[model samples]
Each structure stands twice: as C-alpha cells, then as structure tokens.
Target: MSQHQILSTEPKPFVKWAGGKRQLIQTIDRHIPVQFGTYFEPFLGGGAVLLHLLGKNPEMKCRVSDLNSDLVLSYVTIRDRVEELITSLQTHAKNYHKNPDSYYYGVRESEPKSQIEKVSRLLFLNRTCFNGLYRVNSKGKFNVPLGRYSNPNIVNEENLLSVSRVLQSKKIQIICRDFAAVLSDAKKGDFVYFDPPYQPVSKTASFTSYTNKDFTYEDLANLVDVSEKLSDKDCKVLHSNSNSKEVRDLFSKEWKIVEVAANRSINSDSTKRTGQKELLIKNY
Candidate 1:
C-alpha cells in the first residue's frame, strides 16, 4: 500500500478505551495485505480496527456487530443524530465537568431511559468514568467510578459527524447481535477481525467481565471453530488475544500466530500500564 494512503483519513478514536487496538493498528494493517473483498468485524468493542480500516481502505464494504446493546445504541444514535448528540454532548461537557461528582452519580441514580437521557448518561459516564472503562455489575448498573482527569474533551463534533458519514455510507451495515451471528452471513473473500475480550495471560490477570456474562474457554473454542470454518471457505480472518499458552494452543494448527506488544489498561499502577506482549493470529 502507498505511504500516503491512510494519511488523509481521519484519525482514531478520541475516547480512552480498554482493549482498544489503536496502538496495534499500524502493525495489524502491515500484516494485512491491501487486497481484499469485504470487511467484517464481530466483537466490535471500541471499533478501532473497523474505523481504521474504513479510513485506510475507502473502497471497503463493511459489516460490524457488537453484543453490547448500549454500545450499539450509542453508535446508531450517533450515526442518525450526530448533530443532536453533539449538541447534547456540549451541554453534558459544560454541566458535568462543573459538578462531576453530583452529575456523575446523579445520572447513575436517575435510571434515565429516554433517548436523550440514555445518550447523555452514556456519554457522560463514558467521558468521566475511570479510563473510559465501561464495566457493570451483575445488576447491570453503571458502576465505574469517576476518573482523575480535570478537563476532558467530552464533545467532538467533527469526529462524530465523520462516523455518521461512514455509518450512512451504503456499503456498511451495523448490527446489534451475538458476535457468532456474524459468521453466518460472511461469504468467501471477506475479511474478519475478532478483537474479543483478551483471555487472561495469568490467573491474576483474567478480568473478562465486560458484562455479567463471561467469555469462557468454551466461547474461545467456538470462535476457533468459526475461524476454521471461515478459513475453509477462503475467508481472511484475524484475531487478537493475550499471549498465554492456553490462547496460543486454541488456534495451534489452523492459525499463523505472532506476538506483539500491547498496553495493559486494567492495572491500577500507572507504571504497570506500559507495553506488554500479546498474540495476533491470522488465517493466511
């Protein structure tokens, strides 16, 4: 690919995210050759990969899905009402930053359900939450505490509008469903990228609880099955996971596994947040 290809494309996400692949995008892109048909991404967390691909490969026909309803709603709402969301986000930025403690927990207490409230609460918490980590308890509440940042850019109108343009493009389809459902519609020559919850590298490291539901070993095995089936049909597939023996062994024969560095987001100590190695498996 040309050096100038991705230069003009808009930049990556502004929001801090757990397991976000912004740092790994260039490496991932280098590994993935430019030639491909359509693009598919299941388990789309912050969608760093999809958005990066969209910017780099404008010709891509894309389909992306995620299990989180709130995430899906946020994306859809932004796609449809980006201008309105931006307006509301400006208001949120103004009000929440002024009285963060009250606004943070107030929205948490209000149990707001309407579109306005839901989007506002979602954006508010996302901006203020510690490291932008979206975690919830078994009761399904927004439980992440307020972060340390004094002034965060809560409203980014240009990026929101660009995302809306991408979503509005006829070539893309955004779905809210089980990640496995993505495999059903994927055809030959399609490219699939799975950035699922990283299987813990160590016993102490395993915190896959993005939701109440656990992404167990069984789920990993299921994903391996999906990858193999897709590979058999000549689909190009790539997955990112922790560099653990168990994760490595799961795709032992069928995948081309490579190790690369990744930032550890869950650790409490800022010093421990340095780059650590992770696994990248591709079906070539």
Candidate 2:
C-alpha cells in the first residue's frame, strides 16, 4: 500500500526458521566488512542477513546453502516457482481455514509426491505448526505441534511475490550442501557468514533437530576448524552461536567474539523464552 510498508515487508524470509537472524541483522550489519568480492552464507536458514544484504545491494552476488534438503527445496521453489507456490499455498490456506486443527495434522502427516506439493506442505506446516520451528523426528518427519495462532498468515502474497522478485533480481546461487563443504570455494575477499545451530546452553535445552541429523558438539568443533581455515585464507567470516564456554574456547584462540542479545522465542515455556546471551564470532 505504501513505500514504507513495502520496504518493511518486501523480499523478507518467506518461511519461519529456527535461529533465524532477522532480529540480529542490524547488529551484524554494523560489523559487515565495507567491501568484499562475493558473499557466501553457508548456514542459510531463513536467510535474514542474506536477503537484507541483497536487498540493500541489489547487485550483490551471493551463494547460499543449507544442509536441509526440504528447506533448500522450499527456497528453490519460492525462487523459481513463486507463482505455483502461491497457488498451492492459497489452496492450503483455503482448506486450513475451513478446519484448522484437523487440517493441520493432516497436512503435517502428508507425503507429497511433487516438489511443489512438498514445498507447499513444508510452508503450510511451518506457518501453522508450533512456533514456526523446523524440527523433525528421527525418521525425518515434521513433528512440531500446531501453533496457538487464531489466524496464521498462511499466504502472505506480497511477501512471497517480493521474495521471488529478489531471487530473480540477483545472481544468487542456491545450493543444498554441508556448511563446511560450501566454503571450499571461498576465496580471499569473499565474505562468509555462518549461522549454524547454536550450541545448547544445557543438556535439556538442546533443539538441533533441523533434519533427522543432529548438530552435536563435535559439529561445532568442526565448524570452528573451518572458521580458522577461512581466516587463514584471508576470507572474512562472521558466525553466530550460543554463548557457551565450549563455543567461546573454540574460537578464542584466533577470532573476534562479540556478545549479542537474542530472544529465545521458540520455547513452549514462556518463562524460558527471554533475552539470552549469544556470541557472534568474526575473523576480519
């Protein structure tokens, strides 16, 4: 309706993502290096920083990747098939509004045959499911319960359209790859951002079921090694993770770690969700 509203909503992250960087964009933005060659984001969750950077610099070339195939498929679908996605989402919205509770579970358990249907299922479940979390069981199934929303925005037409336009507007390369593997192509002057699953604060607080696979402590160490290597190669790196002792020690030897406050909003217990300390490590 207005330019301000359009800018506020345009080309935003289409799907809800766990540990998404939307709220931390500005804090991270101030630390983003002045100039760089290509932009590479390995842990492209909802791509808040990626989308924001691209929107501000429309010509910025980018390569984004994630380990989750379904998540990556959703991105590819929205980027290449926004029209079809909108149609499918509209259909889902129509059916969901008719009978939300029953319809939510039905869609949750559904096994779609086509890419469009698969992505539609994912987006539909994400919008309606608990807290927009992307957790799955050991069998790789979507298991988050229905969110407590009287009216979930199942089909944000304008946002989806804007996402498509932004994807089409740039030379953004989307791929499904292991986060560390994606950085092998990184060269000097390339800015790389890592938003890997945050290391858990405690044993009971772990929630890294993004796929059937788990991102364990070893995985965090492996990522630390990757960051060190990237730093050695003179590639600018920015990473975010829980502000735990293990994470700090891993990078303290050779990186800049900044404390960032982020809201832990996805927890079922409202009391547990509050401003938590997180660390954003960088190698400049």
Candidate 3:
C-alpha cells in the first residue's frame, strides 16, 4: 500500500508506560512529514511513538534503539517471541499477585538463565515496579519497589503481535548503544526523533534514571552537533527535552525551539506536581 493510504490506519499500543507519549502523538504527527525515508528513534523508552508510527504507516521503514540493554532485550523478545514472553508474564502475574513483596523482589533478585528469561524478569519487574519507573543501581539490579496496583497488565499479546507484524514488513533495525552512534547511519531524507533523559528543569525534580549512568552535558552537546550535521544533510530532526535555559542556549542556533508545557513526575508531592514547560527542538 502507499504511504498515504497506510497512514489512515488507527495506531495503538498495548502497554502502560510511565513517560509514554500518547498525549503527544498528535503534536508529533503535526510536525512530522507525511513521507520520509526511514524513522529513527535513538532513545526508545516505552516506544509509544514508534508503535504508533508503525501502526499508522505500516509501509514506512523504521529503526529504534535504547541505551538500556534490558529494555532493548524486552523489545527484541516481544518482537521475536511474543507468545513465549506473554506466557512467562502470565505465569509471573499469577505468582506475583499471591505474594506481592516476595514475587516482586524475587524477580528482582533472581538471575535470568537465558535471554528470554531475562526479558521475562525485566517485563515483570517493570509492570510491578514503583510508578512503572525503570531504574537500576550501579551494580545493575532492578531496585524499584512493588507498586500499590493490584492487577497490572502483564501480557500485551495483541500489541506484541502487531509490533512483530510491523517488524516483518520492513527492514526495522534495533540497537542497544549510545544515541550518538545511531547518527553514524543517518543520511539525508531520514527522520530522527530523540527523547533523551530530561535535563531536569529543577534540581529537586530529577529522577527516573534507567541506569546509574547519567546523561551528561557532553552527551547533550554531542547530540546537538549530530542534529546540526543531519540538518545540514537535509535530514529532518526533532528532539524533546526540558525547557531549561541551558538546553535552550545549546540548540538556539540551529533549531526552531518551542516551549511546551508538561507535568513533572520526579517528585512525591502530588500538590506540587503540575504542568511545566519543556522544549521541543526541530529542524524540518
């Protein structure tokens, strides 16, 4: 089918993600072109946008990557063995609901014997973890405590099958590496979307690190440099970050940066948590 025709299909994901961009789908769709060579997402967190795009434009080629190996492994597992992963998740849910603390930390503490087992444990922990947050210590362990939710959806079988179908059609590339490295393969006419760790707008609001490693100032600058080079080569770029002054200053030259409001989730106080502005840098 033609690209325009394919885009008419409704897109949806089967997972509940903490920082998922379901609300921003329309906003992103408005900025993105109707046609592009390939869609590249370097920081593939929940993959809400990627799944949406795949469903909307099944004919479009796409690539997704993440710095977190476990996250990548889960996605790859879902793509390759959706049934197996779903079964494992169902088994976990059955046992977890019985003994919340024990099962929660059991998956957290148990060492996976294989890749699928690793993926299963990761997904189980992610669903039951506090606030659906993906955080790890320096020792590379799942540390998020069990949440209050009694019955979290563990097996998103339909969505997993959809993702797998999308993978089968196009030359979809999945990588687990630094975001900068993905730019090496980017060429003119390619579309790249970056959603990095939020450079905290305030010191107190910083949380949700996927690993002990923090995204440094150098990483942000390197991203800007790569985006600039991509723009020079006529590759469309869009990046989402906190609307901090430092971030604005860095991309002010090349990007058409706009401040858009979003909620701050790093804090525990519900009353203090409200809408705050964030920057969306684009070179279209």
For each candidate, give its TM-score against the true structure.
0.92, 0.95, 0.90
Report the alpha-carbon TM-score of model 2 versus the true structure: 0.95
Ranking by lDDT: 2, 1, 3
Candidate lDDT scores, in order, read: 0.78, 0.86, 0.76
User: Clashing residue pairs, candidate 2?
Assistant: none
Cα lDDT tens digits, model 3, 1-284, are 45444345444554445455776777777777676898899988888788778776667787789887877877787768877887888899889878988878878889978887888887777778887776777777767788888678776555556665666664787889888876778888999999888776778766546767878778789888888888888898999888787788888575798776666564568777677667788986
* Candidate 2 residue-wise lDDT, 1-284, digit = tens: 55456556647888778888888888889989999988999889898898888788878988889988888898888889988998999999999999999999998888989999999998888889888887889998888899889999988888887777778755789989998885578999999998898888888888777878889889989998888888888999988899899888887656888898888776779998787889888877
Best by lDDT: 2
**Alpha-carbon deviation at 227 in model 2, angstroms:** 1.1
RMSD of each: 3.8, 2.0, 3.9
Candidate number that wins on TM-score, 1 or 3: 1
lDDT of 1 by residue, 1-284 (tens): 23344244474564445688888888888777567777888888778888887776656798888888778777788778777888888887888877988877777677766775677677777778887887878888778888887887678666666666666767888888887886788888888888888888778877777767878999998998888888888899888898888888888586799888777767777787787898889988
Question: Residue 141 deviation, candidate 1, in Å?
Answer: 0.9
Clashing pairs in 1: none
